[model samples]
Target: MRFTTRVLLLQLSTVVAVVLVSTAVFIVLAVEQLKQEAETSALSIARTVAAAPVVRSEVALETSRQINPSAGELATGPLQSYALDVTGRTNALFIVITDGEGIRMAHPDPGRLDRKVSTSFEEALRGEEVIAWERGTLGDSVRAKVPVFAPDSREPVGEVSVGFARAGVLDDLPGLLFGVGAAAALALLIGTGATLVLRHRWEELTLGIQPEELVTLVQNQAAVLDGVGDGVIALGTEGVIQVSNNAAEEMFGLQGLEGMSLQELGLPTDVIASLEAGEERDGIVVGDRVLYLDSRQVDRAGQRLGSVIVVRDRTDMMELSERLDSVRAMTSALRVQRHEFANRMHVAAGLVEAERGTEAAEFLRTMRDRGPVDYPLAGADLLTEPFLQSFLGAKSMEAAERGVQLQLRDESLVLGEVGGVEGTEDIATVLGNLVDNAVTAALAGPAPRLVEVTLLDDGPELVLVVADSGPGITPGTLGPMPAAGESGPDRIHGHGIGLALSRDLLRRRGGDLWVIDPGGGESGRGAVFGARLPGVMFPGDDLREDEE
Candidate 1:
């Protein structure tokens, strides 16, 4: 059966059972009550007959005379007449008077007078009155038997018996049952209507889905969520996280994200704003991960079911894009170098053609002495590794495009190269962040904007410093770095998480970053940032040098 029908039927059955049981109980109690009332009335009438002065004196006279009257004489007697009168007036079934020996003095039938009474009369003869339901020649009745006393003696002369028939006692029972039945019917009607209404309400609330189907849906949802690689977050209309799978939690570097607001999870401001506006987005930076976000509202059965957001990791693509830009810069630098080499070769050719062989030899010697790759930065020759030299040479191109001069200080020296090092990524990340920030700050500052860089290798550690001629920042204005494993959006020190992420990377390796100069450093009136990264070079480079 359909769920609604089953529930409605069950409820109706419950109501019916209750009403039936209640009506039956009411009928039984009503019958008993009627019987008790009948008994009480019968007993009351019996007492009145026994207390009549005329009946009492006559019975006393009969007892003293010791005469047994014939049935015809007793039937015409005053006691018989009085019993018949009472029986005729009241609704009693019978009224009888008996002598001390259990002989009936008066009865409804004249022939039965002076005969032995049909029912037991021992209690009445013993001076006690009896009131109970008893069976006799007439029928079952709620009967009362009372003792009549002698006029002057303390003994009972005879007994007065009054009875109300069982039929008469329960005469009003059908009416009582009708009333109880009416009430029970009314209750049933109300119960059935309420049950139907409740069934309808259940359908509306569950959207016609049964309990078992809902369970299956939940199971399917669990399987789908657990099996996906991308992060999926289900949000309520109020933007609270209602469901988050393991991938979602892991991607955000968080736990217990259920019921939490994305705003509280440290997502980028643009990302959160876009989500609140119900817009799809890309290149959302969360922690160190660049993510692509796709969001859509979920609707079912004409009802709005909030929204879902799927996040795809895009950091690798962003890194590749950065590498392509670097390669482009190296190509441009190489093209310029090639042009300059050709110009020098033409000058040497001119010297040789003029027979100035000495100057041509000197020119060739000078060309040999110069480094193979001409880096744009001032101290590029200090970097022996090709990757480090090419990377900064690219950063110089980027700074030049932004109308900021990028250079390296002459004091910079590297005891070991960063190529194939244990923590090359960490070194690159920290150095790149500092230089990027410096270039941006210079671009936003006054004229003569310049960014100066310094790189040094100390044993197993690498140090980097970048200073920019820009509007300096107040030291205390930056938000404090969150504790390890903490996630939040307030970690943004500038336009992005430049300082925060840089410091996090340094601290991850037992290294740290600090403000060497808030502003007005040696090179320019700009802020200077410093970082120390442990284990960026080969650990045994210094030992190998010592042995040598």
Candidate 2:
């Protein structure tokens, strides 16, 4: 059964059990109470009969006659009426007077008189009070015996026996039990039915998800998956294909791969082997592509079930990585070229030093007109020299082209003592993207545009601020802009893919980018992109010293 049905069954069964058990307990206690009430009534009637004036007066007359046989007053009309009145007033199943010889004398039923009863009259004659649950000649009865005595003698002359039928004792019980039991059953049925119905509705409600919402959710997830520039796939525990986003599908040249295995999907042999062995392998070669496959056993509650294989296509990333390696190679070549150019300049300077006066003056005038770099990297450290030189040069050229002034403050501030390789690279990327965005935004302004670049050592963190004077962004794209291709109308893709990529890359490296408070003016006073590189950016044992 479904979960809801099972839960409903358990609940209903519990309720029914409780109701039935409670009803049974109540019935047992009620029956016992009824029996006690019945016994009490019977005892009350017997006591009333024993204490009656008629019974006592009759006994007195009989006793007086035994003392004086000629006492005619003892046999008067009062004594005769006493016997009839005593028998008539006693309300019981059977009331009889028995003589000491175990023979019935006076009885409510006249036919029972002068006859033996279905009781131990001998036991009653011994002055012992007799009571028993026994069947009378009519029906089941609870019988009791009491001895009658003369007024002058302690010895018993006759015994009075009273019997109460069981029918009257249980007269109201059966109806009460039936009524209570029926009500309990009805309540059980109603409660159980209600519980089941609610459970069914809950089941239907959960499964009744709206198609539009599901479609929207799936579409959004698809966009996220496709925008990552990486391949992603989801697999069922059985190793059958569950979902393969377009990136993954395109990477492996898979067409409608709904039921294909890893081996069947033309994966690398090492990857297939590792998957079969249920181990993770990355940076493996598949065909002409170098990819990473992360395989892990899919388990729930510690039970090994199956596995999920995440295939990441590293074709473009690997190419970029190769290009970076090439850039490292070019670093040395550029250094050699700088030295060679420097030697050539020294030679030209020496020649100028020895030249005739007018020719040398014209050369110096030409050099003066050339002007200095807009954002010069002077007195920078060796480690940061190349990056600053390349990045600032590129931005400065772009700024000049767009008629935007790029001002670099504190360019002499040394950054070589900063933390690990990754940290410095992240700082560079952060500053680069911010300045690029600032220049681009400022260029959109009507008049002279300006991008202010500031770098500071704030004791614990390195803060870089890139603020622009421009049309600024729309109020909507104030914060970190959307992913490169994920911008809506208010957020247009800006400055190629550098801004979004830089943000993601920096975030992955344990840093972040944010916007500062606008605080006034139109366009929200243009945008201020700020980056705070944490203490982790500083290398071991490096501390900021007060400048000389």
Candidate 3:
């Protein structure tokens, strides 16, 4: 049943039970009291009639005359007259006067006069008063009997009996019961009204949901929040955490976060700010993971409830995007190489058509020996690794297209196979971002736009250094650098996501990326970026074993 209905029914049943019990008790006690009052009234009237001077004198004379054989039948005229007067005035059921022998001297019924009394009268004749319920000639009654004494003697002359009928004694009981029942009913009605009011208050408190429905809602909420993969946190308008799912606790590396405020949770200031503003934030780095945050304000019935924040892990997504960018760069490089090769092939075919067969053959031989066109990079010959060579060549073509000089410094050297290095993709990411940034910076600067790259992979680590002839690092462009062994990216500088992501990747693999010389190079002042990937090569591993 509905919760409200159940409550009302229970309350009404209780009230009814109480009313019935109370009414029954009241009726019983009232009947008992009325019976006692009737007995007392009968006894008082009987005693008063027996004590009258005329009644005592007359009864004594009658008793004396009855003892004399020649006195004839003692006249009970006075006794009968007194009994009738008292019975008529008090509205008693019967008043009987009997002599000491238990013979009725006077009675309410004329036919019963001078007859033996039907009920016991031994105590009254002996001068002891008596009161009891008895069935006599007159019927059942609450009756009282008292002895009548001679005027000058202590001897009893007769007895006076007075009774109130049982029916008459209880005549007012029905009326009394009716009053009690009315009072009980009033109490029941009041109780029922109070119960209804309480039920309404309960509905308001529970938002009009039944007990069973409330339980189901709680169960469903837990299931849904716990079943989802994405982290969810619900907050009240005061910023207290009301609901935190398992995913949220795991993602934040916390437990028992419910009831804690956002500040108490020790979240990053930017994340808290975003939540407070109810704005969406994407690809924000938190701890060692990249997360996307979405905040939406919740409202119901035109009331502002709170805000819900959804946290989605984006670390893997960021890595995948980096890999796609690498593929695109490689594709661009292949396209450039294909166009260059086509032009060279056209030149060789033209020479053969001009009858310079020997010249064409020599050209093909030289081209085969040289292995593709040189882009005038000063230290490009030092790069023995094919992957780095091709990647740098592609970059060189790209820089040329943008009117920037791309070159490798003389210090660049690698005696090992760069392709076999652990975390090569991470290295590629760092190098690609640095090279692209340098090329862009150089192109934007004044005359002598140049971008120089240095690479070294000998044994223990792989090092990449890129310098651009652009504006040097300036203050207020970066936050504090992360300490060694710390997990997150360094605070953002003037450079955008490229530098941040590159630094993050390097640090995750036990490496570091930094500004070695904020580029005040002697020849051209610009920014210098460097990165070191440690443990890329294990001890005693030959760099050229695979090549051989």
Q: Each model's C-alpha lDDT?
A: 0.77, 0.59, 0.76
For model 2, the run of ten residues with the poorest summed lDDT = 484-493
Which pairs clash (backbone N, Cα, C closer than 3 Å) in model 1? 266-489
TM-score of 3: 0.58
Q: Candidate 2 — which residues are off by over 4 angstroms?
A: 1-31, 60-91, 100-102, 115-117, 121-129, 136-139, 152-155, 201-396, 405-435, 441-447, 450-548
lDDT of 1 by residue, 193-282 (tens): 999899989988788888889999899999989988988999988889999899888877899889899887776566787887778887
Residue 333: error of model 1 in Å?
4.3
> Model 3 segments beyond 4 Å from truth?
1-14, 29-118, 121-179, 198-223, 234-244, 264-279, 296-308, 325-417, 420-422, 430-535, 538-548
Clashes of 3: 0
Task: List, residue by residue over 274-387, the lDDT tens digit for candidate 3.
Answer: 888999877665444567789999976666779999988876787778767766776776776677778889999999999999999998887665445565455677775656
Could you say which candidate leads in lDDT?
A: 1
Q: Which sections of candidate 1 miss by over 4 Å?
A: 51-54, 69-90, 105-115, 135-137, 151-154, 268-273, 285-292, 315-387, 421-429, 472-479, 482-527, 538-547
Tell how far residue 164 is off in model 1, in angstroms: 1.5
Most TM-score-accurate candidate: 1
What total of clashing residue pairs does each candidate reach?
1, 3, 0
Provide the TM-score for each candidate, comma-separated: 0.82, 0.49, 0.58
